[model samples]
Target: MATDPVCKMNVEPAKAAAKVDYNGQLYYFCSESCHKAFTEAPQKYAGAAPPPHSSHQHGHR
Candidate 1:
């Protein structure tokens, strides 16, 4: 599982609605809206550190 940087939701990479690569790292999003927002200005959501990359972490629904 991965953390959706824009909305902070737990998402499975294999089941993610969207995915983006930034600075050699992979990011997952729960919805297209969040993906769009992140693409428009990733810095706004990513902040100082990128979300942790995980395979099966739990997150808010």
Candidate 2:
């Protein structure tokens, strides 16, 4: 899964609705809107680090 730089949504690379190559890296998007938004002003929405994982864990009986 790839993180959409614009919306931070998890995107499946093989099934991504849109994708773009910026600065020699490929970015995936969940929708066309996100793709357009990214392409328009990449600097505004690029290089967003993926959301961090939760440190807490739940135990079930």
Candidate 3:
């Protein structure tokens, strides 16, 4: 399984919607949107740290 850099979604390499090779590393995307986003700015996400997981509650009534 690979994490989609753009949205941090878990994706299966074989079943990925799209894949791209960047800087000698292969990246997989859950959707074309993510693929497009990553290709547009690979550097922005390639070296970016994954967003920390949090359980903050959303405001709801």
Q: How do the residues 1-60 of candidate 3 rate in per-residue lDDT, one tens digit apiece?
A: 899999999999999999999977899999999999999999998878633442244544
Q: What are the per-residue Cα lDDT tens digits for candidate 1 across 1-61?
A: 8889987889999999999988777889999999999999988877745456542466644
lDDT of 2 by residue, 1-61 (tens): 9988998999999999999988767999999999999999997776455224322333433
The alpha-carbon lDDT assigned to residue 39 of candidate 2 equals: 97
What TM-score does candidate 3 get on C-alpha atoms?
0.78
Using TM-score as the yardstick, the better of models 2 and 3 is 3
Give the 10-residue window scoring lowest on summed lDDT in candidate 3.
Answer: 50-59
Clashes per candidate (backbone, < 3 Å) = 2, 0, 0
Q: Rank the candidates by lDDT, best first.
A: 3, 1, 2
Note the residue pairs that clash in candidate 2: none
Clash pairs, model 3 backbone: none
**lDDT, residue 25, candidate 1:** 78
List runs of model 1 lying over 4 Å from the truth. Answer: 48-61
Whole-model alpha-carbon lDDT for candidate 2: 0.84
